[model samples]
Each structure stands twice: as structure tokens, then as C-alpha cells.
Target: MVTAKPSLELVAEVLNGHPRSISRLISRVEARDPECRPALAQIYEHTGRAHLIGITGVPGSGKSTLVRELALAARKTDRTIGIIAIDPSSPFSGGAILGDRIRMNELTGDPGIFIRSMATRGALGGLARASMDAVDLLDAAGFDMILLETVGVGQDEVDIVQAAHTTVVVSAPGLGDDVQAMKAGLLEISDIHVVSKCDRADANKTIIDLKAMLSLGLRMNSTTGWQPPVVRTSAEAKEGIDELLAAIDRHREHLQHSGELAQRRRRTAEMRMLKTAEDILRARFISRDDDIVVDLVERVITRALDPYTAALNLLATLDEGKSDDGGKKRP
Candidate 1:
């Protein structure tokens, strides 16, 4: 275990691209350790250089293989890559269950590629809360490309759009019902659609279906004159890797030239601000004594008050900045 260092020292180490320091700092960020705040605040200044590409899809869509292949292809252009793979949390340990490190063993010795596996830890929308923080740290470390692979939670993984500049939604043939993708809102959020396992016979059908969907203008970003393209790839055959990379590059250029990049950055900032506020409020609510909450629950259970009224009373108490005793003011 790496011992914690002073925030300034840690920040310097991270800025120098020391892998161990980067990993340790990411751990601190993931745990939401208050001690790392100063370092993170400094680190944020060096971010926004890396292109954040979000890859998400349902389970068994071969997302891992595609990511590994994509990284290799990008590295050929001398681009340093940072991959953040979000895995389902282990029930007992609350750690990443499907380790991407093990899966991408072939890319182990490369200094240019950094892979970090994160556990969802019961956070919804397929990403851990600190995933973006980790992205910032890698960006500060000078990675040219950052691939954020979210947990394959069929629907509701749409949260990737808020975090990634280019969102790629992967689909594989034979993944049971296709309607789940639609229900997941992937159709609306994708900037690029990837049909993986294209070597399979049914792969073309998936590509065609995605094209059909795209034709309907389900992707709202089309208003900017950018149409999402469907790229087919077979990781085993190594076909379409360059095409996918080209598409990513083209999308990046499009964003910059069309001025959508600034809009995305603004949207991301707004989301981070709102999310941080919500997190602080939730932490305050959780840390308080449960007496008031318990009393409200009992009243609601006994029919003395409705849930809404009890909630209003609770909020009113919170608004007054009173302590658990309901009279003493908070510092």
C-alpha cells in the first residue's frame, strides 16, 4: 500500500506521470478522501486536453475486446491512452469483479497505455461517482486519449453522455432482445454506433438496424449537422479498427470545428456543479442524527402525517440550520 503524501508533493508526482502516484491519487479520489482535495483541485487545472471517449453497451457485447483492440490501433499513431473500465462491484468485497487488467494482459508492458479498473460500488448509470475525477488525473498526466468503458448495465447507462466528448455505443448480435437498447436510451445518446463481432453472420443485421434507427434522427445532436455513423468491427479478425479510430478522430475534429466542444464542456461543468452540490447535501443529511428522521418515519407510518408533509417538515428543519435537538444552531 502506498502511504499518503502531502497534497503538493502528490500533485507534483502525478504531473510528472508517475504511475504509482497516479494510481494512489485515483484511489484517494475514488474513496472521496477529503485529504486529496487540494491535490485534485490543482490537478483539474491540467485537464481538458485529453479526449474522453465513452464506450457503453449491454453485457456480452464484447466491449472489452473492442477496447483493447481500439487502444492498440490508437497507440500506433503514438497517442498515449488512458482507459477507465468500470466493472460491477463484488458483493462481498465491493471491488471490481471483472478485472480489465487481466483481460488486457497483452497490453501490460506498454508505458503509453494506462488501464484502471473501477468498481461501480452501487452507483447507478454504469459509472462510479469518481470516474470523471480519475479521467482528470489521467488528462493532467498528459494522455492524449481517455477511454471510459462503463459497466454493461443494459438501460440507464446513458449517463456516459454527460462525461464523454465522443460516446460510442457498441452492439453485438445475438444479445437477446434488441428493444432493451432503445429502452436504455442508447439510441438517443450515441455519437457513434459500433457493431462489434462483425465477423459473425448476424453482425450485418445489427449494423443495419442501428443505421435504420439513426435515420430516424433519434440522436438529438444531429441539429449540429453531425450524423452518427455506424462502424462495424471484428476484434478477432482485427478488421475495422482503423475505421473506428478514424471515426473517432473525425468526430473530434467535427466537435472542434463546429463549436460543439465548448457546448459539451459547458454541459459537463454544469453537471459536475449540480452533482457536487447534491453529493454534499446527501452527505450532510446522512451524517446527521437519525432522531428527527426516525420520528418523521414513525409519524408517517402511524398515519399522523403523510410522507410529503413529513418530508416538508424535515426540509424546513434543515433550512433553519438547527441541530438534532431542533433548537441549537449549526456552526
Candidate 2:
């Protein structure tokens, strides 16, 4: 059994290139445990070096394929690749695909590629936080490029993209609703727009439509310097990948030289850490005691208390709990 200290030591060892330790460390972090906190802290300290790239679009838009292509390109430069794919919660079955690894098996033999599947636990609770932690873990593992491919649900696109250094929004050729379906904030969040399945006949039309939509955004975000580029690609044919990689490089360069990258990183770090702190407070101090939790739940459910009121009560309980325990609580 790996003790907490040893486990973190092992994680650091894995970050230096030990594959077995890497797998074990990932498993340890992904599991549910209050004890994982220390390891997470060490991992967080080791991060900020990896370039996190988020990719998202509507379902069936071929996002994963594009990510796979990008992985190959990153590998050519001897970069260690980390992939986090969000398999959304199935509305009916409450299940997730959790199966993309089979399709991207070409990366299996390569020691440079580390891929993991994240189940979007639920509507408000899933995807956002778990995905962030998973990326941080990958970053600490010393991956050069961490590619995050998300299930393209319409809402929350902006929040997800904000977690990364760069974002690529993928769309397929004849997706029909390209212009009307894309979100307004998409243009602001995404660093690049990719029209996948470029071999398809309607790809050019999709490009034209996206360009038209971008023109409509000039009133709001036109002063952001470089315009977001639309790159066409065929993941299956393996065409245009080099250009896409170059485009990503260009965006990274622009962000770095323009002093925008530091600002983005600062904002991301602040939000992530604040969110995590809130979640910890919710789980430990507010929800730890049965009577206080039940009271808050009943208040909310019975409509005797609205959400804000309930939150206030919970915070009060948390404060009382802290005062009682004096910040000492065993896991």
C-alpha cells in the first residue's frame, strides 16, 4: 500500500517519467477521498508548465478525432501528451461512453501519450470541477500538452474554455445549424474554430457561415487584436493537421507576447482555486453534520427558505462548526 507521502513521491517520480507510478497516481487522485488533498496540493504546485488546450463542439462534430490528430502532431515534437475526454452523463441511461480509448488505440504503444476518461457526473456538479482537477493532475505529471475534449452540450461552453490556455471549437461540414446554433460567447472564448471533415462537400459553406457570424461580432470584441482563424481539416484523411498545429502555435505566441497569456492564467488560477475552496467548505463544514444539513435541505425543499437564505444558514452552521472544532477535523 502506498502511504500518502509515498504516493505523492511516487506521483513526482511518475512526473519524471515512470509509467507505472503515473498510472497509480492518476487512479489515486481520481478516487473519492478527503485524504487526496495533500497529493492534490503537491500536484497543483507542480503545474502551470503544461499548455492546456480545450476543444468542444456539438455532438457528432468530430471533436475527439481532431484531438487525436492534434495528439499525433504534438507527439512529433517529442512532447508528452495528456488527454482528458468528457463523456457526458446519458440523459436516460445515466451512463457515459467511457470508450474513446478504444478508438484512439494508436496512442497506446507510445509512452508519451497519457489518456483518461472523465464522466460528467451530473448537470451542475459534473464536467467543470472534475475536468479542472484532471487537467491539473495531468499538468503535474509533466505533460507538455494537455488536450481536453468535451462533449458539446450547448451551455457552459464559456466556463469550460476558460479553464484552458487555448480553446478550439470544432464543427462539422453540414451540421446545418452552424450559425444559429453556436453561442455568442463562443467567439470570445475560442482561440480557433475548426471545420472538421474538410473532405465533405459543405465544409466551405460552413467556413463561410462561421466567417459571417464573426463579422457580426465586430461591435463587441473587435479590439481583441488578432481575429480568430477558421481552419478546415479532415481528421480521417489526416489533412491540414500541420496547419492546425501551426495555428495553435501562432495563437500561443500571440497570447504570450501580447501579455494576454499571463492575464488569462491569472484569472484561471484565481477562479479554479476559489471554486475549489467553496466546494470544500460546502462538503466539509456545511454538509458534514447531519442535523444542520437536514435542516438546510428541509428548508430548501419545503420552500420555507430560498436558495440564498439556505446558503446563508449553511454558512452560519459552517462558522459554528469551525468555532466548535477550532479547525480540527479528522478525515
Candidate 3:
């Protein structure tokens, strides 16, 4: 139960990289109360500035290695990177797995990179609802690139795209059926496709299959500007990492040039507001003598009253009880 107000000094300290305060700010916003609402508002104002890249694929596709390489590439431009690793996937721990990629440890001491691991905690859409809040916190904290990694097979990976501006759906040679098999949910959302572990023999066939599938799926009125491109990369040998990074940068430029960046921000804002409203309504409705609503519904079941009339009566009672000043009845 957070009772105290959100401190301005706390926000500033977190933004300034006060190590102890940074995690605290993230916790506060993710807990999601009225107290943290103001902080979230400020955080969203800075959100459109972060290039959100969602990296996802079926199991063992080397998403972790890919994300670390991408983060390292972003550093070349002096951009701060935030990596969010989700549950049961490629997590070494809640702490960053600096050993996953070479440059991951290369800048462990650098303030430019922030990494956090997330658990499902019983929410859907790849990451938890709190993940968006946490990302907002990171974006406001001045990270230029935020990479969101997910847990699960390909279909589950698609949900991450709804949260990101650029979605790179990774697949590998062993993941042969990823295109035709998982086409319904995740593949439809990809803005970029990645064939990782390209060192393997069947890699070319996987890429060709993906291209054919995309050719079948592309529609005349699609919203995304550029058709997603498949890039090859082998994290183990560090081959094609540069080409993959180049594809990501090209996608970012395309988004900016084609007004898709603004569209993404608008959609993100809309989702935040809708989710927040649903949360508040559920909280208030449950607290409003919920027993009364339950009891009344039981009576309706016995035919003493119709459900519609019973609901109206409940609404009147709720309205009257909530008002400090008397509100007129609905008759």
C-alpha cells in the first residue's frame, strides 16, 4: 500500500542514474496507484522518444544474443540501451546475463545500458501490464533504445509487437515450420524478420520460406510502411550482426519518414488510457459494497426482479453512496 505522494526529487534522482533510486522508481510506477499516476504521466510525455524494439521468436532462436548485439550496436551511436528480458526465456537471472554476448560484458560498467528481467506474474500479452509502465520509466530515464524480449513460442512472440515501434521476429534453421505453422498470430505482426544462427545448414531454406509466406500475407491496405525484411545473423560467430543492426536502423528511419512513428505513439497512448480505465473501474466497482451487488444478483436469478432493473437499482445505489452531495435518482 503506497500512501505517500510521488516525490519530484525521486523522479529526478532516478533520471540522473542514482543507482538505488532507479529500481525504486520502476517499482513504484509498476505497482500502479494514483500516487504513481503523476509519475507515469510525466514518463509517457517522454515515451515517443525511445525506439522500442521487440525481439521475439520460437524457443532456442538466440533472441538473447541478438538483443545484446543490438544493444551493443546502439551504443556505437552513443545511445543508451534498455533490455527487458521476460520470463523463463533466455534469462540468466534478474540481473543482466553479461556473458550471453561478448560486448554485453564489455560495457557492464557503463551507465549507458540498463537491463531488467521480467516474470509473467499472471498477465498476458507477452510481458506483464507493468512492463509498459517500466518501459515508460526507462524511456523517461533517458534510454534511447528499449529492447523488449519475450518468453514462449512464435505466436506468443507477436504480442510484443503491439508494444513496440519495430518488431523483429527471429527464427532459425531448426525452427523450420515457424513461418507456415505460426503464421496466424506472430508472423502477421512482424515489421522485421531475423534468421538467427545462420551458420546452420538449413538457414537459407528458412529465409526463403519466410519470404514466400510474407508474399502471401501482405495486404493492399496494410498500415505498416515497409514490408518486413529478413536478415541473417549468427551470434556465436558474430556473423551478420552488422547487417541485422543496419536493418533495424533502416526500419527506424522508415518509421520516422513515413509518419508511422507518430502512429505508434498514438496507439500506445490509447492502450495505456484504456487499460488504466479498466483497472480503475474494476477496483472501484469491487469496493462499492460488492456484497450488495452479489446479493441482489442472486435475487434476480430467483425471478423477483429482472436483471436490467436490478442493475439500474444497483447503479442508483452506487451513485448515491459515492456522492458527497446528493445526486438525483434515476427513478
Candidate 4:
């Protein structure tokens, strides 16, 4: 006798704001369990309701602190929040080293907020595929706001732009030349520029430089026509948190009014679908132990077939298999 699989209905309590169920569902998604797909399919329909926000900046730019403050403030407004903090992977354990939960200890006790820390796990752009899936689960769970905090590796941290409805680029006063650094794709993707640690003396300079850059039409590929606002915040002091939230609200409104929000969600869905298909195809290819792949590898090693040629042949073999299946069905 076979064991019965868990029903998604069993986890309906998770969808109804049960923290334990939410955690278990996210874990199942992150593990990429095959059974989770059906449950995720049901959950996906309820998504696109939460406001997804991406926060990224330099390593010491105080992103985690700002996120904590933001969560605290958002809670006061009666909003439920789900936060995904992406941390650098540990070299040995391959887990998140910084542990954002510890950093956000204050908010842990709050029933309205859920915080999850994920490791980069060799994924570039500071996010793993699992992280995106987890975000979907959180959104489906009915959170009013979802905040994604990246690993903060400068210009390469642009993946959040695709995943977030509103991308906030955080910067501090003394992180080298702000103007020159902004030229490296951050300016293009930023929907809101935040100058964290505003209590520093050089904070004004950073603000001015960002404003000058914006005035020069530096944003080339923004999704919205609304100019990105620059807001200063000292997360430790909690100053300007309200202003930052206000800017985010305005950007959210702009996205809705300018009809960019729907476009962003559509783009995100398209990308996710393509990525899922790619992963499935890749897994099928790797699992095949056929003589064709062995022969192709040997040919490449012997310099008879170039890698590019061998790759095309492999794909051709897959297509041929599909065609043969179709022919058999017709007969």
C-alpha cells in the first residue's frame, strides 16, 4: 500500500495566516519538492495582491536595519509584512551567515510580520530561484507588503528589479563616490533612492549628488514615468522612516495609475514560466544515460565535435524523440 500524499487543503490554515503553516509551506517550496507544485499552483492564483519591495545597497549600508524600521512602521498602519533577507552564503555550511532573524530580533515578537533569511547559495544577483518561489508563497499567504533585502554587492544586484514591484536602492554617506557608482546600472533600476544613516555629516552631499544625477535624466529604463524620489533615513535613529514610507506609497500609486504594475507582474510571470521550463528541460537532459550523450562527450574530447555542435545535436535528439512520440500517437 502507498502512503497518501498531503493535501493542500490540510494547509489551508497556513493560507489563513497561521505562522507554522506558512513556514512549512515555504520550506516545501524552497526544497523544490515535486508535490509542492500543485499546492503552489493553487497559491499562485491568490498572489499579485501584495506590494513587493526590493531593497539593495552596499554591504555596510545598513539595509537590514532600515528594513527592520520599515517593518515596525508598516505594522503601525495595520499592514502585514513578509520579509526575505538574502545573505551571503557560508563557505562551509552553505547557509546564510549573517542570520537576518537575529538582526531583526525586535520585530520577531510582532505577530504581523514574518521574516525569512535565505542564502545566495552561489546564485548571482543576490537571490536564489528558491527565494523567488518563497516570495510567491508569502504573497499568496495574504501579506500586505513583501520586502526583499538583497546581499548588497553593488551593480550586480539588479535581479531584484525584475522580482520587485518597486525597487529601492539604499546608499550611505561615505561609500566612495556616490555619483560615479550610481552610473553602474543602479540608477537605471532604482524606483526610489534611499540615503541611509542621514545623521552623518556627508549625508547632504550624497543626497545632492543623487539629485544631480536624476536631474540629468540618468534613469534610462525605468518602468514608471514618475521620477524616483530620494529619501534620507537614519535607521538607527528612526528618522525619515515615515518619509521613506510615503515615497514608497507614492511609487506604488504611480505604478497602479500609470498601468505599469500590471505590466511588471506580467513580465515577472513570463520570466518565471520560462525559467521553470528551462529547469525542467535541463533536469531531463542531465538524467538521460543514453549512448548519444556518451558518444557526444567522447567526440568532443577527441576534437571531432565542437562543444557548440555537440549541444545542438543533443537538442536535436530531444526534438526527434518528441516527434517520434507524436508520430506513434497518430498511428
* Top model number, TM-score: 1
**Model 3 residue 51 distance off true place after TM-score fit, in angstroms:** 1.1
lDDT of 3: 0.73
For candidate 1, report its TM-score. Answer: 0.91
* Candidate with more favorable, higher lDDT: 1 or 2: 1
lDDT, candidate 3, 221-276, per-residue tens: 26665878878888777888778778888999998999988888788778777876
RMSD of each: 2.9, 2.6, 5.7, 4.0
TM-score of each: 0.91, 0.90, 0.80, 0.88
lDDT of each: 0.85, 0.76, 0.73, 0.81
Report the candidate with higher TM-score, 2 versus 3: 2
Candidate 2 displacement at residue 173 in angstroms: 2.1
For residue 34, model 4's alpha carbon misses the true position, in angstroms, by: 0.5
**What lDDT tens digits, residue by residue, belong to model 1 across residues 1-331?**
3475766688887888889989999998888777888889999999999999999888878788888999999999999999999898876877666666666777788999999999888778889889999999999999999999999867666788998999998888878667345643887788888889899998877777777767766555557888888899998888998999999999999999999999999999998888877776666665666578788889999999999999889778676665546643321
Task: Output the number of the lDDT-best candidate.
Answer: 1
Colliding pairs, model 3: none
Choose 1 or 3, whichever is better by lDDT. 1
**Residues 1-331 of candidate 4: C-alpha lDDT, one tens digit per residue:** 1123363753576578777776777777766677777887877777778999999888888889989999988888999999999888776877667566766899987888988888777677767767878887788778999999998767666888888999998989988885587676787788999999999999999999888888788455443478888899997676999988899999999889999988998888887788777767766676665678889999999999999999999888887766766523110
The order by descending lDDT is 1, 4, 2, 3
Off by over 4 Å in 2: 1-6, 90-95, 123-128, 285-287, 328-331
Error of 4 at 269 (Å): 1.1
List the pairs of residues colliding in candidate 4.
none
Q: By TM-score, rank the candidates, best first.
A: 1, 2, 4, 3
- Least well predicted 10-residue stretch by lDDT in candidate 4: 1-10
List residue ranges in candidate 3 displaced over 4 A: 1-6, 88-107, 153-157, 219-225, 286-289, 292-321, 324-331
